[model samples]
Target: MTQTVSSTDPPTPSSTRPITRPTVVGAWHDRFEEILTPEALDFLARLDNAAAGRRADLLAARRARAHRIRHGEDLDFLPGTGSIRRDPSWQVAPPAPGLTRRRVEMTGPVTRRMTINALNSGADVWMADFEDATAPAWQTVIDGQLNLLDAIRDRIEFTDDSGREYRVVEASQRPTIVVRPRGWRLCEKHLTIDGRPMSASLVDFGLFFFHNARELIARGAGPYCYLPKLESHLEARLWNDVFVQAQALLGIPQGTIRATVLIETLPAAFEMDEILYELRDHSAGLNAGRWDYLFSRIKTFAQRGPEFVLPERAELTMTIPTMRAYTDLLVATCHRRGAHAIGGMAAFVPSKADPQAAERALTKMRADKDREAADGFDGSWAAHPALVPTCRDAFEAVLQGRPDQRDRQRDRQGDGVAVTATDLIGTPTTTPPWITLTGLRTNVSVSLRYLTAWVSGQGAVAIDSLMEDAATVEISRAQVWQWLHHRVRLAEGLVVTRDLVTELMDHEVELLHAQATDDRDHRHVDEARDVFVETALGEELPAFFTPYAYVRYLVDRPLQPAQRPTAEDLRRSEVVRGHEVRSEP
Candidate 1:
């Protein structure tokens, strides 16, 4: 087997191998020690023996709870969620998963043309979308969003510069059309179809996503979503719970929906598996959001450190290596768990909108397709209708020449697993496709343009300290620590960062084997000890404990509606007012 690389594309080495593995996130170390203290474990042992009889009821209750969850009879409904929050309520158990599992792919303006061309060109599980694809806008945001999706879902066609007309297959043939609404922060500005107001919170975003879910699903589309700008597991859990409630309200089957969370946020990086675990019942897997993730890293670390600001339109290679490493990690992490690691959105190529730029853009788009495929991405997104064919062809070509089936020798360890084939060096490797080279170019553009915004930690996480803001650091630490705990191997009978730690986490993580080790807890411990419930051991902590800031919001506030002008109110003013006053007929 060989590690494949495009002749022109470069490779990025990942430190996920070691060196950057933090012993602990600093804050968590104290808690880990406080709970697992010698005195606590002894107390538990004595209590366990004394309460052995009570264990039966505990086991019975646990089984009953699982049964309720599996049956969907216990769905917890919260209205604020279905409207703006986009969160799903997983209170009711999800039914058996669908046989035809699906993963939706997102495309940006750069690759939209090529991606659409490809969707029409072949059969894909779904062509995911981005409200994040364009510049932020509002005032009928719902209508505008629906229009974009509706247009894409129909028989859309595009023409390339060389007089090549690409008419993609109707969504009927492909059928799955997924549209991800704008996330919480930007959602305050969006309005509903009835021109209603929207809230600015995650719960509100959940409600918005939930309310619209029916419309998207009603038109021969199974409900699906791609989570973006996510901050923590709590955020995902919020979405899961909101979704459950939304379905119940809409009269849909309990678990008829599905989702894929974009692991673009740096803090979301280390906690990839945990986030998915929270949404495992409905998860499709994950994607490494290049532009946003890199942007986020810079915002957290560079802005304040540097005296001068970056250029308006800088070069794109600055973060390619990191992006590559991120994608590699995402793919490895997902595949390790038998899930698909969808590739990043392509940045450029096929500017059918401007004939003059089409040639240059097409070249870049195909290159990105090739690179993404080479990086082990199952598929990538296309922004334009014209780009679809190229993107689709590129994916088909990469997979066509590869193996049809994969072996489950180790039973793929975690959230996902990318199937690999032999490469020139006799090393087993998985890449998206050489076709995605253009994405590198796009990534560079997004990196340079947004680098400043990201470094300032201006996007989502706002708090920062000496190294990174407290929130960003916590999020990052969660992922890193969790991945390490599950994938890394401390020597025989060794403890996690035991060399650096005055503490040890004896959790079993053998189940999350793909995390770092090929077997029992390479990154940290066996899967059996994979998770840590703060509440389960809450009393054990040095005693002062807050569940998590985000968790606090989930428990206390239900998603709610925000302020917005009525149709009559807007019509009598501004754009409409001017047109009316002019009396143009």
Candidate 2:
């Protein structure tokens, strides 16, 4: 039964109006009211009221599934959904406008500067991400909405402290904007409905859709999205339902929303066909979210045994058998259903100062994109603007003036890649002595550094020349837990113990302190260390590190207002030319 909201069908005041107005627990920021209008708050409240129960049920199902996997249950393609996979005639709706030829997609947080940079990055799509790339402070969320609105209206611009301006080009040259909302597992503590924190996923999607769906459609691009961290087909179905209700409430066409689901979690990998089927009417395709997929693998089977233990992070390349099977199956499943198959991110942040380092990074990025192209991926992701050309060139070489290769069905090739359950879960031997002393230290250092930055309201940072986000941090900490839990022996003959991990963490913190530029940076180190210790050395593996850290550091104890940007500060940063960015700053 579909519950549609219309003028005739009034919402229950108790459910729709939780209080006199939507209670904003977060500090008021400049221009937040522009995005969080009374009408918008009501819409979010209604959406949450309708979807909360189902979200809770599905999350419970996830916990149940995790418990079963923890005990003995193995993952396989659902026997019940075999018919859906067997049915070859079904296909997702044709690509929506501006989404047909996505040769390269640039992803970043939705700050004012990033919004300008990504639109001008020359990628076919700009994934303005609110998930891994964003720290999700209250102001950040509101400002992100404002930035997207401004970008859509061609009113966004930014200038650095050096007086260098960044502005969006004319709409003709700009990439299509695709927003990636946060996942289901987190909540927005700032906004509460019925005396509880609202679902972060709904808050993000609702605010964006409510504010931009119709405007984007009028601009010849519908509300495009990249769905992340979905663990099952059921979760996809929940999103489909939300889209239906949202479109109906807004009086938009039913199938206007097109989404590309990131097949990042292990369970989602097994149900790719089902996930696509669930959102078939609105499906764009699936992406190889390699980092979170690795994290999911560790989280799912960490205690199962040594066979499931993976090698160090560096050794877990896309070419590994398990990883190869994942991508091959993704390409096969997507193409078979007439959907595009996108590739993972080339996370290298190329440096021009050191030509050798830049060349090495570009060389690696080119190889990665080239491999994805050959494997039938329609497009790939670039974290930085410099790598966009590399990604596009790779797809162009294979596509050869073509838009996408959905016609290239890898499943029908010679010997027809028939991936099985073992191919995905069964660990492969990749030059043993898995846990090196250096590997442990690197994980500790990287996780601590990233967490410190994250607590300071930076979600994505370039660490060791790679763009490290929450997904990468999850992998880092989760790997440490797995190694410590199993008491894995390092290549240097030191077994992973709590004492050893503590010593290494202290050493890493001291190293960070030595690198700190100010007292604020030093304070963040202690906070970040607390976060690292809680998540990495816990008795039981926490599903995610962000929720707890976010509440403790961001929500409950907010950053000083001075540290956040003001609207006036942003206004003074840039001077926009008429429908074009100034060539000179």
Candidate 3:
């Protein structure tokens, strides 16, 4: 049954709240709040204006076109009041546990080849994503999600290693499929079909996500989606309400629809439990998205150019700490909720473009797989099928207990789960890892923290004896964990604590202490803030925000916006000089 939402979720009535709230949308809802830097303030202000301005412009254009096309005929422009779009958030929702069923993740490059390839990947689910990997083009956004769905369940075809195309009968049984719809701002203008812009409310996008999800459901899957970048629980709740409305319209069951959100933003992180709780009946649990989360952190505190400035993709992928935290947190959060906490992606997928680099990448995969298995991740994803064998082999090998086979279990409990204090450096265990884990509930979070803090700059202190800044604590601590005090069964949940970090690095306590303080220098923070301000005000912003805005800036024509505080020109805000925006009816 779908639960009722509580007041904690922060749902909005249509007239009272704007679609996006800057502070709420930007950060996690933590109890602690900090003053924003002037640059940060400027960036936040622009983000608000940029998202709203583009939305309003798109809305106004629709209204003018509606006036001409129908010659002022009455229209059902907005959905009826008290409909999902206008429901009281909490009143319509209630909390529940173990709301989501099984989950499957989908990811590939944003090429047409990849999109289709992802659809047939041997995963339990698929999400033809528009959020992270896709270049933000509106046509691509529409075409990608709104592809022509054949009525009959078409047999999926793929080329195998031998270059032979075979039909996928039972081989391609994906239980779920979804598309991350475009966000409600500049991207909306780009999805414009014909001469008119797609509305800010994304009436069309909503229909697309709804229609496609239903078709997938009709194909023996369920109505499911992994929603991304949800800044608040209410956002999750809001999506739930939308799903309810769509279901009602489509004649589907009210509670059959489901969503999972990535708690990437700071505010969302703080309010995570609440948000997840609000939509618990329909929520599929949360994901700890690292790159976007870090990017969001920068964006929340710094100026527009600097805040939005991200390190090269390579840096993000290689950041062991970030990846570890994300994977650990996801596993913990999901297991606590009885939902599966899937691990992070394998960033080092080998590319034929660089053979030497590809070989090195394979070596890293071997190391990463060892760590991931050691950390107790149930499953992980890869960008390529070539990496599939590697992933499968790693998961298989860990269960089989290849390396670190020494030491009998030390301390063990909680439903027969065993965790040893003595390290298993090099003893070949006769027992199967799964056999050892029978009836066991392992917390991946607990198992991972001891390792992650080492990589994350948590314990990168100066070495007194080595007399260099290069190394510190985590190395020795990890050696003991990897080779010795083999923590096998009882997996730690993904809740961060200073004790966990310090205790995990117990043997190298002093060295780890020094390494943890290494990031006291804020040079990168300074560089990020400076770059943001410079780029945001540059000529490229109009184009960057929306292709329509870019085109308009060149042609120099006025466009009417549907809502307030719009038009960067303050003078125009006081008058109705620009063209008006509205509906298609």
lDDT of each: 0.39, 0.84, 0.38
- Listed in order, each prediction's TM-score against the native is 0.46, 0.91, 0.50
Rank candidates, TM-score, best first.
2, 3, 1
Clashes of each: 142, 0, 39
Candidate 3, position 459, lDDT:
16
Q: Sorted by lDDT, highest first, which candidate order results? A: 2, 1, 3
Best-matching candidate per lDDT: 2
**What lDDT tens digits, residue by residue, belong to model 3 across residues 1-585?**
111234443433322222221221122222212222333233323333322333444334333433332232222212222133223232212212222222225554233445445555655445555554443333334344333232114533446678866443353353245445544332233322222343323332354434455555555555555576565444555566566555655677776666667665544544444555556667655655554555444333222222122222224442344344444444443444444344555545455667887777777876766666555554455555456557656666765642221111211223233212111011223431221111111111211222233122221111211111111111221211221122222223222232333343342333334445445323322222222222222222211122222222211123323332223431122121133333221
RMSD of each: 23.6, 9.5, 19.9
lDDT of 3 at 442: 16
Please give the lDDT score for candidate 3: 0.38
Tens-digit lDDT track of model 1 for 1-585: 111112122222211211111111112222244332344333222322222222222223323433443343222222222222122222212222321322224343113353454355433544433334322222123233333443444634567799887665544565354445444323232222122222223322343344445665566555666777665554566566655655655578766677778876655664565566667766767876665565444333221222211211123232344455456666665554555667665444343357766676677767877776655666666434455667766666767644211111122223343222111001211421121223222222222222222222122211110111122222323322322233322223332342222122221122223344343224222211211223112212111011121112111123211332232322221121011221111
lDDT score for residue 200 of model 3:
26
Better of 2 and 3 by lDDT: 2
